[model samples]
Target: MIHCARTDKGMVRTNNEDAFYLPEGEDKPLLFIVADGMGGHKSGEIASRMAVEEISSHINHSFLVRGSGNETMQIIKEAFYNANIKIYRTSLQREECSGMGTTATMALFKDGRVYIGHVGDSRAYILRDGCIRQLTRDHSLVWQLLEEGRLTLEEVRCHPMKNVITRALGVDENVDVDLVEHEYKKGDIFLLCSDGLTNMLEDKEIRDIILGAESVGAAADKLIEAANSCGGFDNITVEIILVD
Candidate 1:
């Protein structure tokens, strides 16, 4: 496995509210996470940080006890649930963090398959055979509209409410998480990113950049650079995992 990740505050945001986690060393489990937070003051930053930390801890502990098995999806779902409860409780205890929430996108690689747990608008994509396919759907109002056929793809891109996500961690005690499983082979590349990247570049552009890059690290750097070149109105984060 080959992997790399990057995060940037972008051009407009005063501070980055995005956070990500990537396991280090061969002894670590193959897991990756990205979060985009929302709230007042620095609450967004705290929320995102808390999310990645909590989820990673929970998943790690689960693997230690249960071992990776068919229950992997359930373990990931429970991790998200626990992270949501922790973030929500903190929001109620602190004024600045009130209503704080974050988008959580987690990918767990195990036994020739990837299990994805997603909430809010952060995304997961697979690049295989020179094509890119989105693995998770956006939990945003604009996405709902697009699914309902009420809005076109072009309109959704420029919609004023595109940033308004319908679901997020820490916003409520219970959150609906989307879980998916996909098989992977040698040369398959998986990407997990915050909306900051997609909001700036189209899927085709992302596929092209990943294909053109020499390494996973270079692909991450080029993706961030390309998003920043597009004005970078929001914090950008990207994680690339290549199956070797």
Candidate 2:
């Protein structure tokens, strides 16, 4: 079974632009999501909420939950795509929300396996055997530079456009999701988080907190607090999962 907990704090922002949900059914580890929305006047909040709700709804409505996809990757991809379309259509009708978009990441667990689908910069990571591995790529310009050797990681961090995301929900009608699978083992831990936390905290700092926290819920809380202790420049969201 999977035990999990998550949170979203708008921090200094006037409105919350992050959202997440932990759906309970069989009570096993499954379907955890985190979204960081972009826009103003509550549009970011709506976009993020829409992303979390739609993805959760899509997965809940699908029959794949029990059918098994151990070696398949299509289900994870479809869920993100469906959520993006719905959010796109929503912005079209609500002129007040035009141009709003969000970065999203989802984690799914079944039979000791973990599947992740992602877009934008939000990420999924696993900590096992005292090592942590990032499982998704950041679809941002700074990230592009880092990958292509155009910009250094340190430079990207302090860049004026550090938060300028290159891809997101409702920004384009079409989206590509990063899909990854990890074979779950006892004592493994997984985390899904928005860039808010990452933007303020270093990767090693995060790993240290996760390793030191007493439980998943504690880890989530401590991570949020740690980010705020720094600058808390934006909203922060995190999901921490433990498998047994």
Candidate 3:
């Protein structure tokens, strides 16, 4: 079984605003996703919910992502693009949702490999042989500054504009996403999480937990707990997968 767990908190706000879920079924294979929404009004709920529902609907028996077909990167791009359009159009049709946007990170498991599609800062990580690697690049200004050598890693994390994302769904009609593919292995585990969790826990800390935990649920709980200990100033969301 590929274990998955999720939880969200309001943090300093009045509502538990963040949303995430695992696309469940015994169909082709397992696909999991996490979305973090941003909005000035109550549209945060609408944007994240729209993203999850659209992606889930698009993946159900519509595409044959198995065997040799599983390696096709173009299929992954189109599916994500459709989801972006679905949410963007929905936002355009409403007033409260006008300024809404969300960060999304999702993985599709088929055959013996996994394909990841991501936008904004929500991230995907693969853990194998007790090593953890970040699989998605953050589309944010701080990330751009880091890449340009204008800011150090330590400085970038705490920058005032660190939360400002450069790209997201529902903000524009066209979106640029990062597609990542990795072959599978026995005892491999994958984690999808929002920035709230990463903001408090360092990469090495995540590696240690994924390595030491007895099960995927335990590992996810430990990660969220670690973030809460540091401050929990924002909502935290996580999904863990163990491939066997």
Q: What are the per-model numbers of colliding residue pairs? A: 0, 1, 0
lDDT of 1 by residue, 1-244 (tens): 8999999999999999999999965777799999999999889999999999999999887864345555888889999999999999999999999989999999998888888999999999999999999999999999999999999999999999999999999999899999999999999999999999999999999999999999999999999999999999999999999999
* Tens-digit lDDT track of model 3 for 1-244: 4677767672555555467767566654477888888886878778887787777666664656444544345665676688788778878888777888888888887767788889999889988877888999999999999999999999988899999999998888999878888888778888899898888888899899878888888888898888888888777899998887
Which of the numbered candidates is closest to the native, going by highest lDDT? 1
TM-score of each: 0.97, 0.93, 0.93
Q: Give candidate 3's TM-score.
A: 0.93
State each model's CA lDDT, in order: 0.94, 0.81, 0.80
For model 3, state the Cα shift of residue 39 in Å: 0.4
User: On a 0 to 100 scale, what is the lDDT of residue 70 in model 2?
Assistant: 44
What's the residue-level lDDT of 98 in candidate 2?
Answer: 87
Off by over 4 Å in 2: 27-29, 65-72
- Leading candidate by TM-score: 1
In Å, residue 116's CA in model 2 sits off its true spot by 0.7
**Positional deviation of residue 72's Cα in model 3 after best superposition, in angstroms:** 4.7
Better by lDDT, candidate 3 or 1 = 1
